[model samples]
Target: MLVFELVCNGTVNDILHGGNKAPLKLDLRLIIAAESAQGLAYLHSQAHMKIWHGSFQPANILLDQNFMPKIAGFGISRLITEDKEHTCNVIGDLSYMDPVYLETGLLTLKSDVYSFGVVILELISRNKPTHSVNNRLVRRFLEVHKEGKKATELFDKEIAVTMADLEILDCLAVIAVECLNLDVDQRPTMTDVAERLLMLNRSRRSQAV
Candidate 1:
């Protein structure tokens, strides 16, 4: 028999948009990002039966007493059997849903990567879900990235204190941009994403030490 503990910190959505302006610690947020990426990596690759987190969003990531993230919403996820890659279902939050999946009902591994990218952007900017199909938050950042500018103006003022943090944040933005790439073939796998994030976490920690 298996049991799960209740999360006190609730979902990432709760902490970010829970009608409170109080800041979540940058260090903990970095940890959450790494852990969440690890969890997604497991689901995507290591699970006995490969699972697709059909609805990967901030609202589905729960935090425990340690503020460690546990992904929710597997109940709605589809299992990948053999070499099958997609299901004919249009499921996911509009804000974080992959545009290709929304249109073609072809949910691939890259689809979840796209959603994870949005969550990364949200963490950096503390932005909420954009109900509109045209996401201004994602678009503006991409534009800034294309211009090779740091776009420090878009970083959340509360957490953008140190030069190190800004540099780390810029790298995350670059990763997010890659994840949000229009060509699904160009996006990195969740394993690649998790490794990159873990490297970033380690790099940040080394700097603090």
Candidate 2:
């Protein structure tokens, strides 16, 4: 059996809910989102075959001592193969399940994209999908964005912010919205999201320096 080193910092969900009095900093969330996207991109873009991480939720995301996100839980993973009989009866978390997959019982790369979109939304909204009441939350979020509402309002209240960081926060919110598009075909690929997030991370780091 292969053994992996223990991550001292626990999971992303634990840190988010530990009542540390200080929530995760906006910059840290950005970095986490970017890193998570990179991992998903790698899984999806493998030249030999694509791997679908059926359960990609915050609880499955472990954090190292440095607070970096490492995606876990490949027990339900499925490889795209020529076998048509290999249908995935098991779906991801209710909050993260792609609507199409729920209806069709077919596991595709788009299902992973949909789940990643939910994770992105959860990161920005600081709300668990199980806690969310309606499907309209994403729609309402986009509507608010269109109406020029202050995007920082979407962040967790415990997180402190400066006026200078508002623009970056807004950009992050917009990206999250893009990921949550109801139509999977309309949503950006994990690879595209990863690249964009990488650019954003670099831009922020340059500005900080």
Candidate 3:
């Protein structure tokens, strides 16, 4: 028999909008980002076989009563070998697909990193991967970033951000940018991304106290 734990809080996708529920708080968003990054890091590094989550996104991330994130939907993940070239036809939400992967059909660890970057931006902006205002969130984000605009300008209205919290938001934005680099080699590994987020979350909590 198989049993599944009930995720009382629903998914990251739901929490973002929080239709009837309370919108995701900034601190909770940080915690969710850190936990999701750790979940991806484990799948990419510590698993018996390195699993590449070809379809990582907000909807696939389940949240518990305490808002802790658990990554789901491994049914489509690719099990890759160290020496094996893990390449396949592109399959995933187009809004979050890595340009390099979409064009080359070469799925790599960096591809997941790129997708995670989109999720990060989504969490920060409370915008879908492709919004009506901007067809592609990542491209729009990069464009605004290149124009020397602050990440605070893009922050979701529901998330309360004071002057003090801007630095933390900026740090997360920088990490997201690294993950979304067009050049696959420039992206950081999931482990690195996870650790960086964890540290930032801790710092934010410390400052809140």
Candidate 4:
């Protein structure tokens, strides 16, 4: 028999899709994002074995009673050696799959980074990655950001807008852009990703006081 701890809340997908209902606060969202990042960082670097969550999506992240994040759905995860840069027969959610992997049948840690970037974009935009207006959420976001538009324009109104919030969100947006870089070598590591989110979250909290 298998026993599982109860996760009172649903996945991030449920919260994002819960229209007309109360949405998650900005800080809470940031917390969730940070916790998820930490979890991924552990998998990618801090763990006894390096792991790649090939299917890192919002649906795969479970929330506990306190709204803390617990990464789930590792059915497709891979354990890799330090020297292994890529793998074959690439597999993952279509919307979150790294384009390089799609083209070369290679899976790298950066592939997971790209997927996480899409998740971050979903948290900010409240848009489904697979249901994007431009077919691909990352491309749309990159195009818009390249136009010199404020990143706040991409965010959902669930979080109240303040100058400080916008500043932090912008910082996150920049991180997201780097994560989605077409060149896998240009993407930040999971550790870098986690640190950046935590710093932004801390800054926001300090400003709130």
> What are the Cα lDDT values of the candidates?
0.86, 0.74, 0.82, 0.82
Give me candidate 1's TM-score against the actual structure. 0.93
What's model 4's overall lDDT? 0.82
Per residue, candidate 1 scores C-alpha lDDT tens digits across 58-82 of 8899999888999998755645444
**lDDT leaderboard ranking:** 1, 3, 4, 2
Give candidate 4 regions above 4 Å deviation.
Answer: 18-21, 78-88, 131-134
Return the clash pairs for model 3, or none.
none
Question: What tens-digit string does per-residue lDDT give for candidate 2 at 1-209?
Answer: 99997798888777766667245777888899899999998988954667777778888889898988899988667444535414557545777776676767776666777777777767767776762345554655677878978666666654436654676667777777777666778888889989988998888898889
**TM-score: which candidate is best?**
1
Q: Cα deviation of 83 in candidate 1 (Å)?
A: 6.1
Instruction: lDDT winner between 2 and 4, please give it.
Output: 4
Q: After superposition, how far is residue 119 of candidate 3 from its true place, in Å?
A: 0.4
Prediction 3 TM-score vs. true: 0.91
